[model samples]
Target: MADEVKLLGVVGSPFVCRIQIALKLKGIEYKFVQEDLANKSDLLLKYNPVHKKVPVFVHNEKPISESLVIIEYIDEVWKNNSIFPSDPYHRALARFWAKFIDDKIVTPSFKSVFTVDEKEREKSIAESTEALQILENELKEKFFGGKEFGFVDISAVFIAFWIPLFQDIIGLKLFTAEKFPNLYKWSQEFLNHPTVKEIMPPRDPLFSFFKGIHDKLHSSSK
Candidate 1:
């Protein structure tokens, strides 16, 4: 019998989706335990003692934190379907892009939507566009990543999934069909995957719900 796996996540999180994608790819059976960020449960706090963040995967009895870490662990443990490249160099390259996004785009992308200040919005846009440009240049000749769906492709697909929802929040049109054709095509390909398409939140619900949350978080902070 397979080990019992439990995931602590909030559907609102793209971070949670990363692990969910990997687990589905590996055909793992697991129970999802939803966590409320505003009032975190004891399980989430216990599993993720340091960060106390969602998307924590408990495999058997061992707790794994961080989405990327959880995904990599899934890829390793369930080796039948691999997310990283076979070659060591290629695997390193994939990790490089993942790290780049974590460092460059993720935080600013979140801030871009929640921040009301013009300066903050401008900064987020500038940083995000620069990061996107790097991806464009690197992945130009690629379904998404260097002839096959690899780790970089997996990490990048989130940009497409969330960008439109984010545009609604920011009241802008930075990511569009015409603006980034390559990225647009990649987005369609990534989202069209049966597993991804099936599990992802619908645009109407995700955007409307997150918009309200964004407004609430910002308002309460003021």
Candidate 2:
């Protein structure tokens, strides 16, 4: 287990943070390589030639891209702690939630939160809030995936971490203590866990980074 491990990721991406959390949870030591999204590293290009995205996991000498793929890879390589369900059905359910968040929640919510137009913003917000509510229902009494911390937990972990920051920045309360009481409280629990707490990025810094990303995205579009 002496092979060199290096992670090339942009500091700001929640996707990248997902990879970081996976590595930390597994107690895997690796060199952290900060990448400039504006000016990508040769390693990122060389590794993930297709999407050329960050949060690329380099194990030994091979590179793996996509946060979820990286997470699964990390879990497989380091067996000290497993983050997925044991039963076949449970594993599929957990994977369903993860894919739902990726395909259903994250992108739509992001669009809603960052739109400049009020009407468009409202529409996006409605869609985002509906998605959040659906998630709230799913999380009614469940804590973590099947038995404990696993794939679903790791997959949606960013929602707990970034929602607060995004709420502040967007000036809209998508999640509320009264309205989404379970999720609100669950967030506190998840964020306070020693493992999550240690690896979690500062809220202020994440907000600042997201603001930069929002600006950067808008800047290039216009």
Candidate 3:
């Protein structure tokens, strides 16, 4: 019997996109169930009761929560296309950078772009720029995995795709080519990949979605 594989996710979520990218890279056949996060379904609550979040990966009726965990699970199960390096040390390094990207880059960058308070936003922008610089310096190759799209690249899916939308929406330029040449170049290359291109959210609608949030937050802050 064939395995039952399903992904519970919301549209335009970068975390969810990470799973989609990994699945596509590994050539996995699965079902994508779109979720309305505002009114989360019973399945979502049942699968991930603690977070009640999307991007719950279900394989053979077993549910997996968290994007990074699901990604590692997918990599382990599907051996054909290995996402992490073969060497244990390299794999550990990749994981380290991924964690750093999530903890240091993602939070500050999002706040730098979306926060309503001017002072807080400035602080976030400084921290975000510092994080980007570290990432840029670490990037010594075309892609994070040297030449191939691998673990670290997948971990940084947001920096490549979503951040551009955020920048455009708010007219804030924290990740410019002049400021971080390597990362800027990496983002362009990453976006051009066929698999990455397939799953990226369309600019107009996604922009509108983000804009709505941006306006709402700013208005509420006032």
* Strongest candidate by TM-score: 3
How would you encode candidate 3's per-residue C-alpha lDDT over 116-193 as one tens digit per residue?
889988888788678888898899999989889899999999999888788888787777889888999999999999
lDDT score at residue 105, model 2, on the 0-100 scale: 64
Backbone clash pairs for candidate 2 read: none
Q: Please state the error at residue 29 of candidate 1 in Å.
A: 0.8
Which parts of model 2 have CA positions greater than 4 angstroms off? 140-142, 212-222
> In lDDT terms, which candidate is top?
3
Clashes (backbone N, CA, C under 3 Å), per candidate, total: 0, 0, 0
lDDT of all predictions, in order shown?
0.80, 0.77, 0.90
Superior candidate under TM-score, 1 versus 2: 1
Query: Deviation in angstroms for 82 in model 1?
Result: 0.9
TM-score of each: 0.92, 0.89, 0.97
126 Cα displacement, candidate 1 (Å): 0.8
lDDT head-to-head 2 vs 3, winner:
3
Candidate 3 runs further than 4 Å off: none
lDDT of 1: 0.80
Error of 1 at 178 (Å): 2.1
